[model samples]
Target: MQHLMLVPVLLPLLVAALMMLLGEERHRLKMALNVGSCAALLAVSCLLLLRASHDGAPQAVGVYLPGNWQAPFGIVLALDRLCALMLVLTSLVALAAALFACARWHRVGVHFHVLFQLQLMGLAGAFLTADLFNLFVFFEVTLAASYGLLLHGSGRARVLSGMHYIAINLAASALLLIGVSMLYGITGTLNMADLAQHIPTLRASDRGLLHAAAGILATAFLIKAAVWPLNFWLVPAYSAATAPVAALFALMTKLGVYSILRLWSLLFGDEAGASAQFGSLWLIGAGMLTMAFGAIGMMGSQRLGHLAGYAALLSSGTVLAVAGFGQNLLTAAMLYYLPASTLAISALFLLGDVMDRWRSPVDGADPYEPTSEAAPFLNARLEPTRGFNLDEEEQALVGRPIPAATAFVGLAFLLCTLMLSGLPPLPGFVGKFAMLNALFNPLGLAASAGAQPGLTGWVFVLVLIASGFLALTALVRAGIAHFWTAQGRGPLRVGLAEGVPIGALLLSCVLLTVAAGPALRYAQATADALHAPSGYVQSILGAEPVPSVAAGSTLDETAEATP
Candidate 1:
């Protein structure tokens, strides 16, 4: 069971290597391997989550030393509730995106399966690594894979967006390196736990250097998290990518948020004396501004893809602000919002692809008009094609009719809209409500004295409400344009490959709503563990190498202890 921590990082790497050896024509086998690896990853992540949660009375944290050396001297992987939860989320989203890609996107480009698996490996490593250096390595790995994935279909739009994406990320990577090097020079150690243990004892003169390095590091992460002015590249890049790739990219921004949450709490929490909550004010200010920017973008978006992109930014900003609050309850609520928004945005991307196809002109006829043989109740004929095309000019089918696909797309869009907008009966609303409740009652129902939310809290509440309203208004307008105003579209040919993944994502959101009780409890526990990370630090730094027997030791004595 202790060795299970290595599987998430190793399995995808092995599978990717194997897939690389095969010819590109062997796509089916590669697809099978990729999907199988993802499924296995999901299973392993669930076990890790359970173990971290201590449901089986196991340790709450597990540490693995890759080179069999003691901590601070060797590479380390640490798994806790937060890391396990992220692994699970990554696997779930990756699996869905892989399945959706099997319909067409996988074959459109070379090395798709290999890059996909590598991306997963990088994500898992980033979550599991116990040092700042390895985090930088994994960030580069993930970014490299994303560069290829973004250009999978090779359109002018993709090429343009991909270049900008590459340039910005390359700059961020340089900043990350500079920050990490500065920290190492200042502290003499790159291990996160060691840094956490050493930070509070630093001399007053060095504190300025430390904060500068930390700020530089945080700037890189905030750019990835799409916070305000640094986030100009997100919508264009996301909107231009192929659907399945766009869906997978939904988790990429959240990874930035995850890094901020992890490092901020672990290194700068209350235990850090003078450096406690080092940049809370900056985080709050930037996060609120990010929300306002996203809201305005959402209201002005002309495409559903653009809307989904801005919605992601809004979600990131909301979580960042909550993290700034430094309240366990609010953090728990943000955790809930995190996954709900991710699933919704991913579904919206996939559904937007289908909607784009539905609105497209077929057989040179007007896109809005039905053919002579088309009727409201009849099935429209699908023209067999080599594969799905990304261009609007390509004709894939003809005629128009009402079918189950239309109904499915419409209903799924509604759920996504409601979830993104934080409307009733969904996990989005539930998450926001929890945050508001925590803000108004910081004492969590046990205290007799009533409390008032301060000016910052009130401002946060207003931004949250206003973002939701703008999202709702924007989505509702887009929905009307797609579903009501252009009603005569052909029956959408939603393949099982495409429909299943979208349905699964939305259904997961629904399940989240239904199981809010247990989920919230888990989230609250996770948040509590994050805010107080002494256990995590100890587990990482205190891990010891396994005992070895001397060459001259007797077989019986070695067997008795080793096994």
Candidate 2:
């Protein structure tokens, strides 16, 4: 049971390392290895999620202390319902991306499978780690893998975007290290459970330093979260990547939101004496502003990639703001919204890639060229003639006309737009309704707290409504331009490989809507666990009580003594 907690992190690391040693000529072997690994990961994640959710309270948290060292003394990996859920989501997306890439994108670069595995490893580690230091480490690992993947194809636009992405993240990384150091200096431990226990005991003066460190750390995380002002780099970087890469990148922003939600609730949520609700106002205010920014950006976006990027920002803002509310119902709704929205955006990205390719000219003619034309066209290569050849006289016949793949593209596009824009009959609308109901009903936050939502909360509501409206307007406009107003360049060929992943993603959203009751119940349980983190702390710390002396000791002295 304990060993399973480490599998998510170690399995990917081992696969990535093994892939690195394989030869470039072994493409088929590489593809098989990648698919097999992703399938195994998905299977393991599902089992872990089932165990975490079904097992009894204490048993639900599976904690592994490496080197047989105790908590706060060695690296600890903990898997609870929340971590298991994230692992499942990560593996699902990863598997989809891996399958989609195998269609053709894998040939664009060396080490594609290796880098992909490394990225998954990092994401899993980030979600499961019990210590702040390891979180930073995992962040670096993920970012490094992304940096390589961003420039995999090696084009001018990709290079330019990758440069900006790398530079900004490197700066954020520096801040992360500095903030972690400061927190360690003040609290004497890097374990999240330990930090939560120690924070309430800090002196007033030390609390000021702790707040400053937290502020720096939040800045780094918000940058990754794609929060306003700090998120200028996300649109360009994401918009320029290859389709499969962009789809995987959809989960990157969620990682930041996950970190903020987890750490904020554990360390500061009405628990840290002087620091209780320390940054709630900032979170709500910044999140609302980010939502507004994304809405505006979506309205102005001319490219499909940019529209998807802005949509991601909007999703992040919604989660961040709901998290700020500190209401269990809102958090539950946000949890449901997270995976639903991510899968939708990922499908959109994949669809965009196919659209881009379908519209592209092959040999200065329609990409879907006629197969039976009698003209022996010099550039007659198309989907049907991948490896075969024809004599000049025999190839001189006119190509056979085939129906365009427009139906699949248009239908998928409509579904994705509906999901992204929160239209009725989709999971997006259900999640939004759940959130709005929680916000306005008499039994909700306002009535229970004996207070109105105030100007800010109301503003959040207005922004939420307005963002959805803007998204709808933008998607409608884009849809009409691409599908209704435009003439078909040629008949597009949608391959089974490409169509399957998109369909799976859309189907998942439908399932989410169908199963909303049970899904939301699970989300509610997750929100409860987050808000009341005593169970989380106790799970990590085990039967022994937290050491009081550790709370007062200086981290520098502790560091010196440990070595």
Candidate 3:
């Protein structure tokens, strides 16, 4: 149990290294390894979450020090309710994406399994690491893997989009490094717990530099979160990538949100004296703008892929705004919304590929627009085929059955549309309602004298409602064009690999809806833990190094030397 914290990072690192030793021709072995590793990761993440949530435990937070070094001096990894939840979410998405990729996408490129495992390693590390410097290291690892994954298919459009994606992320990485340097120069420690401790005691002269450094650091996170003005690259690049890659990229955006939530709450909570709640209003404003931009983009998008991309942007905006509010209940609701929206959007990405293939041109003509002569049942006249009679073609179509694949695709699309639009009875609607409830009654009890929502709250309500409407309209239009008007098409041959993963994701959404009570309770606990981070701080900083095993040395003697 003590070593479990290391498995999320080490397991993937070891697996990827082993896979790298195998030749590219051994795809079956690679696929098996990828799926097996993802499953193991999901299992480990669940165990961590349970451990973090146990009520009987003295402390739910677990901190690990590599080489048994003390905190603020050597690397630290901490697991609490919030980080544990994120780990579970990351593992779930990765597993589904890996299963879907095994159908065909993995074969399209080289080193895919290796990169996939490395990507998981980075994500796990980013969520677990408790310092600024190692966060940057894990960020690079994740980005490096994503770069190769984005260009896996190697097309002209992918090349162009990949270049843009690479350039922007590289710039963000540079900003991150600079910010880390400035922060270290000012505070003299990079551990987040240590920084939080040092922030309140800083000299008056250093406050300005601290804020500047924090702002630069935030810009990098915002860029990755796809906030407005910095997110123009998201739709084009995401829509151009292959299906499975785009699905995995959904979690990548949320990683930025997680970073902001983790750092901001720890460093700027009520304990920060004059710096408490700094830049929060800016976060709210940016979030609103991002939501509006994403909603408008969704309404105007033509392709399903583009719509899915915009939907991801909209989801990011919603969570960012909610997090900025700094209210415990609102953050809890956003936590529920986060995973639900991510899973639905990922399903949309995978479904879009099948729909696109389903609508491909057959025999150089529109499959849905047959001549009226072929169907004299219609009250219109049209030219007939030169070699075949209209009556014979119509007779040939009389008993043809609708394909099972078509039905499955249409049904899956409908469910995705409902979930994304936040319609009733789905987890999406439950999440939104929870947010609205929390916004109006922030204390989670009867309304008090000054409990009314402010102007920004009302504006956020309007944006949330309007975005759902726009998303519904756009998806309905796409559905009508694809499913309703089609008359004659061949059966789509969906592989079992593809169908099963989609089913599993959608079923998970259903389970969330059914079990909203416990899920919300967990989310509330996570939110509470985040806002009151003393436990997190103490767990990391107060942890002692393991005593050395040198001969003839007392345990106290080995532990007495301070790092």
Please report, in order, the local distance difference test score of every candidate based on alpha carbons.
0.88, 0.86, 0.87
Off by over 4 Å in 1: 55-59, 364-402, 445-453, 551-563
Candidate order by TM-score, highest to lowest? 3, 1, 2
Error of 3 at 409 (Å): 1.4
RMSD score of candidate 3 (Å): 5.1
Which residue pairs overlap in candidate 3's backbone? none
TM-score per prediction, in order, is 0.90, 0.88, 0.91
**Where in model 3 is the C-alpha error above 4 Å?**
55-59, 362-402, 442-453, 486-488, 551-553, 556-563
- Locate the minimum summed-lDDT window of 10 residues in model 3: 444-453
Return the TM-score for candidate 2, rounded to 2 decimals.
0.88
| lDDT at position 343, candidate 1 | 92
Tens-digit lDDT track of model 1 for 513-547:
99999899889888887878788888888898876
